[model samples]
Target: MNKPDPIPARLAALKTTPTPDLKQQWRDLFDSEPPPFNRRYLESRLAYRIQELAYGGLKPETIRRLERLGEELDGGDRSKRSVRLDRDRPITGTRLLREWQGVEQIVTVTADGFEWQGRPYKSLSAIARAITGTRWNGWVFFGLKNHRGRT
Candidate 1:
């Protein structure tokens, strides 16, 4: 006879598990302290860990391919790799929209830089400054950067 599947139930429990208990599970599973991320992040990472333990993780070749792709994206610069690995950078061809003062602002991500108001910009802060007529962190202005742990 075949055994019952527990991975589905384990994954489901993550949705309802309390934060403290989830952190305990993280300690047990990862053998390390849980990251200082939000509950959603904890739940998602815990769910992935549960499945990975029950089944398996990516193959070596797949991981190598991903590393190669990262190197290609960042030109093998370790410092830049952190940014790419964080998945914070928007992909090319993305359209970021913001509304301010009853007007809609649009910025298009291009291969080289960003396009706002039919003009090329080197960084989001520049665009944000143009939009607000004041200095501002572009990522925060665009609602992309999370101000976690900031007073």
Candidate 2:
């Protein structure tokens, strides 16, 4: 089998040929100066812009990247501001209930009641009972009042 000729030699020969200056005949049309480029600042700005775009959306991958960017901006520590920016961003196919009693502990919502950890609970009290294995403080997880209107 014969080896192919090197392409670099042909490219080098082409480099010796003079090329016409395309911009030589063109004059400045506008007096405005070109924008200054700061690579680090531009990268940080872009990261933040992407993060803002992902906020309050259902894109999990973008949200995760935004969290990482937040952590980076916070010097690798996630502050309350960063957390609040990324928190409660809902995922698709999941309904969010606001201010509903025992919503957090409710694993699955049914027509009658809610289920937690695969156990049948008639109410939040029943779920608490099954979870804590005790009668007292059963309403703690639900954040509800037992009988005295105290959580």
Per-prediction TM-score: 0.56, 0.26
Question: lDDT (CA) for every model shown?
Answer: 0.80, 0.40
State in Å the error of residue 99, model 2: 18
Q: Candidate 2: lDDT over CA atoms?
A: 0.40
Ten consecutive residues with minimal summed lDDT in candidate 2? Answer: 21-30
Number of the predicted model whose lDDT against the real structure is largest = 1
The parts of candidate 2 lying over 4 Å away from their true place are 1-106, 136-140, 144-151
Give the Å shift of residue 98 in candidate 1: 21
Per-residue lDDT for 1-151 in model 2, tens only?
Answer: 9876554453343333322211111112122321121222223333343344444334799889988997777776644443221223223322212122322333454555555666554555566566556674433333333244432
* Cα lDDT tens digits for candidate 1, 1-151: 9999988988898877877899999999999987654566678789988888888998899999999999998899888754431255688998877766646688998888899989999999999999999998787666565555231
| The candidate that achieves the highest TM-score relative to the unseen native structure | 1
